[model samples]
Target chain A: MIDNLILGFQTALTPQNLLWCFVGVLAGTVIGLLPGLGSTTGVAVLLPLTLDFEPVTALIMLAGIYYGAQYGGTITSVLLSTPGEASSVVTTLDGYQMARRGRAGAALSIAAIGSFVAAIFSLILLMVLAPPFANFALKFGPVENLSIMILGLATIVSFSGESRIRGLAMASAGLLLATVGMDAATGTARFTFDNVNLLSGVPFVEVMIGLFAVGEVMYQIRVGAAAPIRTRFRELLITRSELRRSIGPIGRGSVLGFLLGCLPGSGSTLASFIAYGVEKRVSRNRSQLGQGAIEGVASPESANNAAANANFVPTLTLGIPGGGTTAVLLGAFTIYGLQPGPLLFQSQPKLVWGLLVSFFIGNVMLLVLNLPMAPIFAQMLRIPYAYLYPIILFTSFVGAYSIDNNMFSVWIVFVAGVAGYFMKLYDLPMAPLVLGLVIGPLFEKALTQTSALGDGDLLIVLSHPIALVVLALAVLLAAGPSLVRLLPRNTPDREREPAGV
Target chain B: MSTLIRIRGNGEATVYAMLALVGLAAAVSGAFYGVFVDGGRVGPGFLPLVAGGLTAVLCGWLALRGVHGRRSHPPGGPADGVEPHLAEDINPVDDATDDDVDISGRTRRERIHNLWKVFGLTLGAILLVQVVGFLAAFGALVFVISTWIERQPLLKSAVIAAAATGLIYGVFGLFLEIPLPGGLLGLGTEG
Candidate 1:
């Protein structure tokens, strides 16, 4: 581990890596702070721009964008009562209240501090746990891999919010879309309709750009932003008492977040929500929550940031994405000509370790950038949504066009954007759809291999102990919500929020 | 049935019904592709068949549940419908948002109109891309969206459009070496 850390620092501390990391985090912060854009859209829209760079450098920068958004989303939630991302949704409850009480600076500062602490804590956990997880995954066969894929799909059941069926529908839609290209098993075209572009299948990067960036812009256009609460620069500092109040929540949130984040599909948003809920139940100042308690901001913020890092655990170790953004990142690995999964750790140790180490540097940089400059960052809220929306649309189009240097990709963006708009309108879960798209090819390959191993019996997955256990777990995850719903309820339950990206 | 349809809400139910059709289409296509190919190997369409079939069933179930299903709001969640914060997620899509000005019906229509306008102009830009070229066409779309949809002043919108175009040309086209569609202008390295 020490040797790996040294190698990571050696690679990450390079002048080029550091420069891109700074750029990535800065871009990510601005992207997350914007009303219409979030980290997923941020990474998707900006990924094509990194095509000129080394794969490791591009990934480091993109990963920076991922974590940097965690801090950036807190700003809007605190000041404007607009959350830039789903994870920051919990923050706005008490964060905005803190601002209402003239403690905006304290809220923002504590959020940054909590997020920074959480990032370090989770990154350490990620670093320690991911290698061992990858080692275990290396032992997995095709049958086991197929079952794990089922488990991955089943995790989407947890993202079902109030409608398990809708989530399933979306996941199926994604899988259906993935089957458009030529069949690798038989070398026969399946759903291509003789179009060469379709033969390659729908590119996940372009789909991501469409769904997150273009789709989000359209959504934000209909729902305009509110005017932000003005905060003076002098009021941005955190006093000792506020930091003291934040300690417990921050610690609690970090642990809760990292654990939830490591689970495929749950990701950071759920982590933040559950962390906030736990703090509400357990904190000594619980009654003050949702009012102006610093605990609310600190806990969710820490959890979200920690969860963001923990998301890398499954992503790096299992090649199964922990959320929507990591799903896109996994797609990026394929685009970069690198196979994603356990082997990646052995084949690309420097790349993997360097990326992990850069998280530390990036969070430290975010803390330094966010703590003092938050008020200045808040000023960005003044930019009208009108200007931002057009910029996003235009970039999305251009980015799509650049993907294949053809018009078809742009058309895909348009179609996917419209689809994404309706999907959001209907409250459908987007993450499962994306994960399905990403994991589709892998799942199919595993199934094919497993079937061959079982002499044409696809049910051969049932015989392997690991595969059986994984399949059982998948069944449990999928059935858990519905079973709970069927059981008699003792108390009224608030409908759960979608485990959004 | 009329009462049930009304209670379930037309817009969302229609969306689910359409998805069911899409799933049916996929399943049909997968069946055509052959679920089991030669040598008894799982064919290319097997998973799609399974997934598509599942999608159809799930969506069909959803189309029924909408008559009066439980809401997704957390039990103790704030009633203001504050949408969850997400960087990768959009803002204030549902019941959330303190935007007081949009309460009027006219403004609501105008907002929906803006969304349509953006979508339409993008289609127009896509067609125009093969004519004037990608950058210019997209830039025009940006300009029209800002001036027309957003109602930004002409000069400001134009400058914004120009800057955006310049950024795209510089970063993606020039720097990344990812060829942009040259279209008629032939500015991009299409060959």
Candidate 2:
């Protein structure tokens, strides 16, 4: 393992790879600060540009973007009180308060420090656990695989938002959309409506660009951009006492973030929320929570970054994307002709290990970039949406068209954007749909293979102990919350907001 | 009829119910096109059938709940019945400040108008990209959006549009060689 780590660092430290890593993080921070552009959209819109690079370098850059965006989101949340990403929402609870009290510098500094600590912690866990987990996953058969996929879907639906039913419906819609192309079983075209483009299925990249990038632009235009409040950076350094108080919360948040992030469907947003709630309950100064407690700023910032990095585990090992951003990364893996599953470690050791190592370097780069530069990044909020959105629109169009060098995909982006706009307006979840789309083909194949192995006996799933246990857990995940609500206990924990991708 | 009308009156619930109906229709179409297959031999339509059916059932339930007015506020907001979709903060200090943008004050008609304008412009650009070229179509889009919807000065709009077009063309075309659509410009191959 030490040898592999050495090899990873050697590869990641190459001039070209390091340069791209810096560019990726820089671009990621810019996108993260931009309202409505989350990591998923940032990755999707920028994916085509990476196609011309070496696969390892490309993956390194993309991973940099993913975690860099986590740090980027904090700038807006702390300074302007406007969360740039869903996961940053919790940060705004106390972060904005700190900023208002002229402690923006302290809040931002602690956030950067906590993020650096948590990212390193999670990356360590990922390094130790990913290889063994992949080896364990290699033992699973079609039945077990299908059960696990079901479990993944169940977790996504359950944590998607206040409306589990709506989340499930969106997932279903995504599955239906995935089934649009030629069927693998019979070579029969389903839902193509006889269009040649439909023969290959809806292009997932175009869908992502449309739904996330284009849809966000349109939504922003309609809402009209607000002039951001500017905060002058007074103290870039956190006081020793403030740092001392944040240590425990940061530690707790790191562990909590990593665990939840490893779970399929549960993501950084949820991790941040749970971390904030826990900090409030257990902190020595609980009453000061919403009133700019430094621990409040520290915990969620650490947790979100940790969770963002930890999400890589399931994505790499099990081929189950932990959330929307990783789902897009999964798509990128497919685009690069590198299937991210248990075999990826064996087949593409350099790429996998190099990406892992690059993450370590990327976090260091982000901490350096964000600490003194957060105030500068906050100035990005002042860029008028009128001027900025048109550029986003143009890039989105070019991104969609460039994928296949055709206009058909561009049209798909337009339609998907419209659909996305309405979905957002109606408060329907988007992450579940993307998850379902990415997992649909795999789920279907696993189910069919399981059936074939079972000789068409549907009950065969019940006979496999592992599959049965996973399915049981899926059932429990789906029903446990509602069942618990029926009990005569204190009113349930606050209904969580829909998680951002 | 009255009960059905009442149910339809709930805007949020109606939308989900309509979506469920669409899913049910798709499920029926899928079933008609292929057999469900017996004895664990799943057919081509198996996934659609299951997914669509489940969507319909779940969405139907959501609609019913909405009709019953059982909709509960999400957890982050205060426990007050005020819909926290854009609710102000609970802290008096934060609430007293009026720095946040209040788009919620915009009338529904104005909001819809803005949405259509943006959507229409994007759709126009998509159609125009194939007819004129990427740069030209995009240039026109930026101009129209800035000048028309945003009501910027014509000269300013043109400058912004030109800069944007040049930037995109240079990056995707000159640097990456993406082979963007030439269309009428004939600068590159018609994609």
Candidate 2 residue lDDT tens string, A272-345: 87787788668998779878899888998899899998899989998988888888889889899989999999
Model 1 residue A171 CA deviation in Å: 1.4
Runs with alpha carbons beyond 4 Å of true place in candidate 2 = A490-501, B1-11, B70-112, B187-191
lDDT of 1 by residue, A1-501 (tens): 999999999999999999999999998899888876888888888887777789999999999999999899999999988778767877988899999889898889899999999999999999999998999999899898888877877876654544556667788888887887987777878777788888877888889888888877787666655778887778877888888889999999999999889878766887887787788668999889878899999999999999999989888888888888888788778778887789988999999999999999999999999988998998898887778788888888887777677788898999989988876666767877888898888888888888788778887877899889988988987877667666564543233322321
Q: Write the per-residue lDDT of candidate 2 for residues B1-191, one digit (tens) a residue.
A: 46468668866667678878877977887786574566548778788888888878887887777767675332122211111332345211223222433333444345457769878877787777667877888888889988887777899889999998888888889788888887776644344
lDDT of 1 by residue, B87-127 (tens): 22323445543332442222545777778888999999899
Using Cα atoms, each model's DockQ against the true complex is 0.41, 0.39
Task: Candidate 1: list runs displaced more than 4 Å.
Answer: A482-501, B1-9, B38-40, B67-106, B185-191
- Residue B156 displacement (Å), model 2: 2.9
Q: Which ten residues in a row have the lowest lDDT in candidate 1 chain B?
A: B73-82
Model 2 pairs in collision: A456-B39, A495-B75
How large is the i-RMS for each model, in angstroms?
5.5, 5.6
